[model samples]
Target: MANTKSAEKRNRQAQKRRARNTTVRTTVKTALKKARETIATKDAAKTPDALKDAIRTLNKAASKGVIHPRNASRRIARLTKAAQASKAATK
Candidate 1:
Protein backbone atom coordinates (compact mmCIF):
# COMPACT_ATOMS: atom_id res chain seq x y z
CA MET A 1 0.00 0.00 0.00
CA ALA A 2 3.05 2.23 0.07
CA ASN A 3 2.63 3.88 -3.32
CA THR A 4 5.48 6.40 -3.30
CA LYS A 5 9.13 5.36 -3.63
CA SER A 6 10.01 7.02 -0.36
CA ALA A 7 7.08 5.35 1.39
CA GLU A 8 8.14 1.94 0.13
CA LYS A 9 11.71 2.52 1.26
CA ARG A 10 10.52 3.65 4.65
CA ASN A 11 8.33 0.58 4.95
CA ARG A 12 11.26 -1.68 4.21
CA GLN A 13 13.37 0.10 6.79
CA ALA A 14 10.62 -0.14 9.35
CA GLN A 15 10.24 -3.86 8.77
CA LYS A 16 13.97 -4.42 9.16
CA ARG A 17 14.12 -2.39 12.34
CA ARG A 18 11.06 -4.18 13.72
CA ALA A 19 12.66 -7.56 13.16
CA ARG A 20 15.91 -6.53 14.79
CA ASN A 21 14.18 -4.89 17.74
CA THR A 22 11.95 -7.91 18.25
CA THR A 23 14.93 -10.24 18.35
CA VAL A 24 16.76 -8.10 20.86
CA ARG A 25 13.73 -7.66 23.06
CA THR A 26 12.96 -11.36 22.97
CA THR A 27 16.52 -12.27 23.88
CA VAL A 28 16.52 -9.84 26.76
CA LYS A 29 13.17 -11.13 28.04
CA THR A 30 14.29 -14.73 27.77
CA ALA A 31 17.36 -13.99 29.84
CA LEU A 32 15.24 -12.24 32.43
CA LYS A 33 12.77 -15.13 32.57
CA LYS A 34 15.53 -17.66 33.04
CA ALA A 35 17.03 -15.63 35.83
CA ARG A 36 13.66 -15.28 37.51
CA GLU A 37 12.91 -18.98 37.22
CA THR A 38 16.32 -19.86 38.62
CA ILE A 39 15.70 -17.61 41.58
CA ALA A 40 12.18 -18.88 42.09
CA THR A 41 13.46 -22.43 42.27
CA LYS A 42 15.62 -21.33 45.19
CA ASP A 43 18.85 -22.56 43.72
CA ALA A 44 20.79 -20.09 45.83
CA ALA A 45 24.08 -21.46 44.66
CA LYS A 46 23.34 -20.37 41.09
CA THR A 47 21.15 -17.31 41.52
CA PRO A 48 23.84 -14.72 42.12
CA ASP A 49 25.57 -15.51 38.88
CA ALA A 50 22.28 -15.76 37.03
CA LEU A 51 21.20 -12.43 38.40
CA LYS A 52 24.48 -10.91 37.23
CA ASP A 53 23.92 -12.25 33.73
CA ALA A 54 20.34 -10.98 33.68
CA ILE A 55 21.44 -7.54 34.79
CA ARG A 56 24.08 -7.47 32.12
CA THR A 57 21.56 -8.48 29.46
CA LEU A 58 19.11 -5.85 30.61
CA ASN A 59 21.77 -3.17 30.60
CA LYS A 60 22.89 -4.16 27.14
CA ALA A 61 19.33 -3.99 25.80
CA ALA A 62 18.81 -0.62 27.40
CA SER A 63 22.06 0.75 26.03
CA LYS A 64 21.04 -0.39 22.56
CA GLY A 65 17.64 1.30 22.99
CA VAL A 66 15.81 -1.99 22.70
CA ILE A 67 14.23 -1.12 26.02
CA HIS A 68 14.05 2.05 28.06
CA PRO A 69 16.82 2.53 30.61
CA ARG A 70 14.42 3.17 33.44
CA ASN A 71 12.40 0.07 32.63
CA ALA A 72 15.54 -2.01 32.42
CA SER A 73 16.84 -0.65 35.71
CA ARG A 74 13.55 -1.33 37.43
CA ARG A 75 13.45 -4.87 36.12
CA ILE A 76 17.03 -5.43 37.22
CA ALA A 77 16.30 -4.07 40.66
CA ARG A 78 13.26 -6.26 41.08
CA LEU A 79 15.10 -9.31 39.85
CA THR A 80 18.03 -8.63 42.18
CA LYS A 81 15.76 -8.24 45.14
CA ALA A 82 13.89 -11.42 44.33
CA ALA A 83 17.10 -13.35 43.89
CA GLN A 84 18.48 -12.05 47.17
CA ALA A 85 15.30 -12.78 49.01
CA SER A 86 15.16 -16.29 47.65
CA LYS A 87 18.70 -16.85 48.81
CA ALA A 88 17.92 -15.49 52.23
CA ALA A 89 14.83 -17.63 52.55
CA THR A 90 16.73 -20.78 51.73
CA LYS A 91 19.51 -20.06 54.20
Candidate 2:
Protein backbone atom coordinates (compact mmCIF):
# COMPACT_ATOMS: atom_id res chain seq x y z
CA MET A 1 0.00 0.00 0.00
CA ALA A 2 1.06 3.56 -0.62
CA ASN A 3 2.26 5.42 2.48
CA THR A 4 1.81 8.98 1.22
CA LYS A 5 -0.75 10.95 -0.79
CA SER A 6 1.55 11.29 -3.78
CA ALA A 7 2.41 7.62 -3.58
CA GLU A 8 -1.24 6.70 -3.69
CA LYS A 9 -1.80 8.84 -6.73
CA ARG A 10 1.25 7.38 -8.43
CA ASN A 11 -0.03 3.89 -7.73
CA ARG A 12 -3.34 4.73 -9.30
CA GLN A 13 -1.62 6.15 -12.36
CA ALA A 14 0.52 3.05 -12.61
CA GLN A 15 -2.54 0.84 -12.56
CA LYS A 16 -4.15 2.78 -15.37
CA ARG A 17 -1.00 2.73 -17.45
CA ARG A 18 -0.61 -0.99 -16.81
CA ALA A 19 -4.10 -1.67 -18.02
CA ARG A 20 -3.63 0.46 -21.12
CA ASN A 21 -0.28 -1.15 -21.90
CA THR A 22 -1.79 -4.61 -21.48
CA THR A 23 -4.54 -3.80 -23.93
CA VAL A 24 -2.10 -2.43 -26.49
CA ARG A 25 0.18 -5.42 -26.03
CA THR A 26 -2.70 -7.82 -26.51
CA THR A 27 -3.73 -6.04 -29.67
CA VAL A 28 -0.19 -6.27 -31.06
CA LYS A 29 -0.02 -9.97 -30.24
CA THR A 30 -3.33 -10.63 -31.96
CA ALA A 31 -2.26 -8.74 -35.04
CA LEU A 32 1.06 -10.55 -35.21
CA LYS A 33 -0.58 -13.94 -34.73
CA LYS A 34 -3.11 -13.26 -37.43
CA ALA A 35 -0.35 -12.13 -39.78
CA ARG A 36 1.64 -15.30 -39.09
CA GLU A 37 -1.42 -17.45 -39.69
CA THR A 38 -2.09 -15.68 -42.94
CA ILE A 39 1.51 -16.20 -44.01
CA ALA A 40 1.42 -19.87 -43.10
CA THR A 41 -1.76 -20.39 -45.08
CA LYS A 42 -0.07 -18.74 -48.09
CA ASP A 43 -3.16 -16.86 -49.04
CA ALA A 44 -1.58 -14.36 -51.40
CA ALA A 45 -4.54 -12.06 -51.22
CA LYS A 46 -4.80 -12.17 -47.47
CA THR A 47 -1.10 -12.30 -46.62
CA PRO A 48 -0.26 -8.77 -47.71
CA ASP A 49 -3.24 -7.30 -45.97
CA ALA A 50 -2.46 -9.17 -42.77
CA LEU A 51 1.16 -8.13 -42.92
CA LYS A 52 0.17 -4.51 -43.36
CA ASP A 53 -2.21 -4.70 -40.44
CA ALA A 54 0.46 -6.25 -38.25
CA ILE A 55 2.98 -3.60 -39.20
CA ARG A 56 0.52 -0.86 -38.49
CA THR A 57 -0.22 -2.23 -35.03
CA LEU A 58 3.48 -2.56 -34.25
CA ASN A 59 4.12 1.01 -35.32
CA LYS A 60 1.28 2.22 -33.15
CA ALA A 61 2.58 0.33 -30.15
CA ALA A 62 6.07 1.73 -30.68
CA SER A 63 4.76 5.27 -31.08
CA LYS A 64 2.81 4.86 -27.84
CA GLY A 65 5.97 3.57 -26.09
CA VAL A 66 4.26 0.31 -25.17
CA ILE A 67 7.06 -1.41 -27.12
CA HIS A 68 10.50 -0.18 -28.05
CA PRO A 69 10.91 1.26 -31.53
CA ARG A 70 13.77 -1.12 -32.25
CA ASN A 71 11.75 -4.05 -31.01
CA ALA A 72 8.95 -3.13 -33.33
CA SER A 73 11.38 -2.68 -36.20
CA ARG A 74 12.90 -6.08 -35.56
CA ARG A 75 9.53 -7.75 -35.46
CA ILE A 76 8.41 -5.96 -38.59
CA ALA A 77 11.59 -6.95 -40.40
CA ARG A 78 11.36 -10.60 -39.41
CA LEU A 79 7.72 -10.83 -40.36
CA THR A 80 8.35 -9.14 -43.67
CA LYS A 81 11.22 -11.51 -44.40
CA ALA A 82 9.08 -14.52 -43.60
CA ALA A 83 6.28 -13.15 -45.75
CA GLN A 84 8.66 -12.58 -48.63
CA ALA A 85 10.15 -16.03 -48.31
CA SER A 86 6.69 -17.53 -48.29
CA LYS A 87 5.84 -15.63 -51.42
CA ALA A 88 9.01 -16.80 -53.15
CA ALA A 89 8.41 -20.40 -52.18
CA THR A 90 4.97 -20.23 -53.66
CA LYS A 91 6.29 -18.85 -56.91
Candidate 3:
Protein backbone atom coordinates (compact mmCIF):
# COMPACT_ATOMS: atom_id res chain seq x y z
CA MET A 1 0.00 0.00 0.00
CA ALA A 2 2.97 2.31 -0.38
CA ASN A 3 2.07 5.23 -2.63
CA THR A 4 5.58 6.50 -3.29
CA LYS A 5 8.52 4.64 -4.78
CA SER A 6 10.69 5.44 -1.78
CA ALA A 7 8.00 4.15 0.54
CA GLU A 8 7.80 0.92 -1.41
CA LYS A 9 11.54 0.44 -1.10
CA ARG A 10 11.31 1.12 2.60
CA ASN A 11 8.53 -1.41 2.89
CA ARG A 12 10.66 -4.04 1.23
CA GLN A 13 13.57 -3.25 3.53
CA ALA A 14 11.34 -3.38 6.55
CA GLN A 15 10.07 -6.81 5.59
CA LYS A 16 13.60 -8.16 5.33
CA ARG A 17 14.67 -6.59 8.62
CA ARG A 18 11.57 -7.92 10.33
CA ALA A 19 12.38 -11.46 9.35
CA ARG A 20 15.95 -11.13 10.55
CA ASN A 21 14.90 -9.51 13.80
CA THR A 22 12.31 -12.18 14.40
CA THR A 23 14.94 -14.88 14.14
CA VAL A 24 17.11 -13.14 16.71
CA ARG A 25 14.13 -12.70 19.02
CA THR A 26 13.27 -16.36 18.65
CA THR A 27 16.81 -17.38 19.51
CA VAL A 28 16.81 -15.24 22.61
CA LYS A 29 13.48 -16.61 23.81
CA THR A 30 14.36 -20.22 23.13
CA ALA A 31 17.72 -19.91 24.89
CA LEU A 32 16.16 -18.29 27.93
CA LYS A 33 13.42 -20.89 28.11
CA LYS A 34 15.86 -23.74 27.81
CA ALA A 35 18.04 -22.26 30.53
CA ARG A 36 15.07 -21.81 32.84
CA GLU A 37 13.87 -25.35 32.25
CA THR A 38 17.31 -26.69 32.99
CA ILE A 39 17.38 -24.73 36.22
CA ALA A 40 13.89 -25.84 37.21
CA THR A 41 14.77 -29.47 36.86
CA LYS A 42 17.63 -28.99 39.35
CA ASP A 43 20.06 -30.23 36.78
CA ALA A 44 23.02 -28.56 38.41
CA ALA A 45 25.40 -30.37 36.17
CA LYS A 46 23.97 -28.79 33.08
CA THR A 47 23.03 -25.43 34.57
CA PRO A 48 26.40 -23.83 33.86
CA ASP A 49 26.40 -24.89 30.24
CA ALA A 50 22.79 -23.88 29.73
CA LEU A 51 23.35 -20.55 31.41
CA LYS A 52 26.39 -19.93 29.23
CA ASP A 53 24.36 -20.48 26.08
CA ALA A 54 21.55 -18.27 27.35
CA ILE A 55 23.94 -15.48 28.22
CA ARG A 56 25.68 -15.79 24.89
CA THR A 57 22.40 -15.58 23.03
CA LEU A 58 21.29 -12.60 25.10
CA ASN A 59 24.56 -10.75 24.51
CA LYS A 60 24.31 -11.45 20.80
CA ALA A 61 20.79 -10.06 20.65
CA ALA A 62 21.81 -6.98 22.61
CA SER A 63 24.85 -6.35 20.47
CA LYS A 64 22.72 -6.67 17.35
CA GLY A 65 20.23 -4.11 18.76
CA VAL A 66 17.46 -6.68 18.91
CA ILE A 67 17.15 -6.04 22.66
CA HIS A 68 18.46 -3.31 24.94
CA PRO A 69 21.75 -4.05 26.65
CA ARG A 70 20.26 -3.35 30.05
CA ASN A 71 17.38 -5.68 29.35
CA ALA A 72 19.77 -8.41 28.34
CA SER A 73 21.84 -7.85 31.47
CA ARG A 74 18.75 -8.06 33.63
CA ARG A 75 17.63 -11.29 32.03
CA ILE A 76 21.05 -12.82 32.43
CA ALA A 77 21.12 -11.80 36.06
CA ARG A 78 17.74 -13.33 36.77
CA LEU A 79 18.61 -16.52 34.98
CA THR A 80 21.87 -16.84 36.88
CA LYS A 81 20.09 -16.30 40.15
CA ALA A 82 17.54 -18.93 39.29
CA ALA A 83 20.28 -21.37 38.43
CA GLN A 84 22.05 -20.58 41.68
CA ALA A 85 18.90 -21.08 43.71
CA SER A 86 18.23 -24.40 42.08
CA LYS A 87 21.77 -25.49 42.71
CA ALA A 88 21.46 -24.52 46.35
CA ALA A 89 18.20 -26.40 46.70
CA THR A 90 19.70 -29.51 45.24
CA LYS A 91 22.62 -29.48 47.65
Candidate 4:
Protein backbone atom coordinates (compact mmCIF):
# COMPACT_ATOMS: atom_id res chain seq x y z
CA MET A 1 0.00 0.00 0.00
CA ALA A 2 1.36 3.37 -1.04
CA ASN A 3 0.64 6.02 1.53
CA THR A 4 1.77 9.01 -0.56
CA LYS A 5 0.68 10.12 -4.04
CA SER A 6 4.24 9.94 -5.31
CA ALA A 7 4.60 6.45 -3.94
CA GLU A 8 1.44 5.37 -5.73
CA LYS A 9 2.71 6.83 -8.98
CA ARG A 10 6.00 5.08 -8.55
CA ASN A 11 4.25 1.81 -7.95
CA ARG A 12 2.23 2.24 -11.13
CA GLN A 13 5.35 3.00 -13.08
CA ALA A 14 7.05 -0.04 -11.65
CA GLN A 15 4.20 -2.28 -12.70
CA LYS A 16 4.35 -1.02 -16.26
CA ARG A 17 8.10 -1.42 -16.39
CA ARG A 18 7.88 -4.91 -14.96
CA ALA A 19 5.43 -5.97 -17.63
CA ARG A 20 7.61 -4.60 -20.40
CA ASN A 21 10.75 -6.12 -18.93
CA THR A 22 9.11 -9.49 -18.63
CA THR A 23 8.35 -9.58 -22.33
CA VAL A 24 11.90 -8.70 -23.20
CA ARG A 25 13.28 -11.26 -20.80
CA THR A 26 11.04 -13.92 -22.25
CA THR A 27 12.16 -13.12 -25.77
CA VAL A 28 15.80 -13.31 -24.78
CA LYS A 29 15.34 -16.61 -22.98
CA THR A 30 13.45 -18.16 -25.86
CA ALA A 31 16.06 -17.07 -28.36
CA LEU A 32 18.85 -18.48 -26.21
CA LYS A 33 17.01 -21.78 -25.79
CA LYS A 34 16.41 -22.12 -29.51
CA ALA A 35 20.01 -21.36 -30.32
CA ARG A 36 21.28 -23.88 -27.77
CA GLU A 37 18.91 -26.51 -29.06
CA THR A 38 20.02 -25.94 -32.60
CA ILE A 39 23.61 -26.28 -31.51
CA ALA A 40 22.94 -29.36 -29.44
CA THR A 41 21.19 -31.01 -32.34
CA LYS A 42 24.29 -30.40 -34.47
CA ASP A 43 22.36 -28.58 -37.14
CA ALA A 44 25.32 -26.58 -38.42
CA ALA A 45 23.29 -25.06 -41.20
CA LYS A 46 20.76 -23.61 -38.76
CA THR A 47 23.00 -22.95 -35.76
CA PRO A 48 24.70 -19.88 -37.16
CA ASP A 49 21.41 -18.17 -37.91
CA ALA A 50 20.04 -19.13 -34.54
CA LEU A 51 23.13 -17.81 -32.79
CA LYS A 52 22.87 -14.57 -34.75
CA ASP A 53 19.25 -14.12 -33.74
CA ALA A 54 19.99 -14.87 -30.10
CA ILE A 55 22.87 -12.43 -30.04
CA ARG A 56 20.74 -9.78 -31.69
CA THR A 57 17.99 -10.22 -29.15
CA LEU A 58 20.46 -10.00 -26.28
CA ASN A 59 21.96 -6.83 -27.70
CA LYS A 60 18.51 -5.31 -28.10
CA ALA A 61 17.62 -6.12 -24.49
CA ALA A 62 20.87 -4.64 -23.25
CA SER A 63 20.38 -1.49 -25.32
CA LYS A 64 16.87 -1.12 -23.91
CA GLY A 65 18.28 -1.36 -20.36
CA VAL A 66 16.24 -4.42 -19.59
CA ILE A 67 19.58 -6.22 -19.08
CA HIS A 68 23.05 -4.99 -18.26
CA PRO A 69 25.35 -4.61 -21.27
CA ARG A 70 28.07 -6.67 -19.62
CA ASN A 71 25.61 -9.38 -18.70
CA ALA A 72 24.41 -9.60 -22.26
CA SER A 73 27.96 -9.65 -23.53
CA ARG A 74 28.84 -12.49 -21.19
CA ARG A 75 25.87 -14.50 -22.39
CA ILE A 76 26.74 -13.81 -26.01
CA ALA A 77 30.29 -14.94 -25.40
CA ARG A 78 29.22 -18.17 -23.76
CA LEU A 79 26.72 -18.87 -26.53
CA THR A 80 29.33 -18.17 -29.16
CA LYS A 81 31.87 -20.42 -27.48
CA ALA A 82 29.37 -23.24 -27.23
CA ALA A 83 28.35 -22.74 -30.83
CA GLN A 84 31.94 -22.87 -31.94
CA ALA A 85 32.62 -25.99 -29.92
CA SER A 86 29.59 -27.68 -31.41
CA LYS A 87 30.59 -26.64 -34.89
CA ALA A 88 34.07 -27.98 -34.38
CA ALA A 89 32.78 -31.27 -33.02
CA THR A 90 30.46 -31.64 -35.98
CA LYS A 91 33.29 -30.97 -38.36
Cand. 4 Cα-lDDT: 0.98
TM-scores of the candidates are 0.91, 0.99, 0.94, 0.95
Per-model lDDT: 0.90, 0.99, 0.94, 0.98
lDDT by residue for model 1 over 47-88, one digit each (tens)? 878888889989998998889999999999899888878878
- Model 3 agreement with the true structure over 1-91: per-residue lDDT tens digits: 9999999999999999899999999999999999999999988788899999999999999999989999999999999888888888887
Candidate 4 per-residue lDDT over residues 1-91, each given as its tens digit: 9999999999999999999999999999999999999999999899999999999999999999999999999999999999999989977
Off by over 4 Å in 3: none
Span of 10 residues, lowest total lDDT, candidate 4: 82-91
Clashes (backbone N, CA, C under 3 Å), per candidate, total: 0, 0, 0, 0
Best by lDDT: 2
How would you encode candidate 2's per-residue C-alpha lDDT over 1-91 as one tens digit per residue? 8999999999999999999999999999999999999999999999999999999999999999999999999999999999999999999
Model 4's TM-score against the true structure: 0.95
The alpha-carbon lDDT assigned to residue 13 of candidate 3 equals: 98
lDDT of 1 at 81: 87
Worst 10 residues of 1 by lDDT: 44-53
lDDT value for candidate 3? 0.94
Best by TM-score: 2
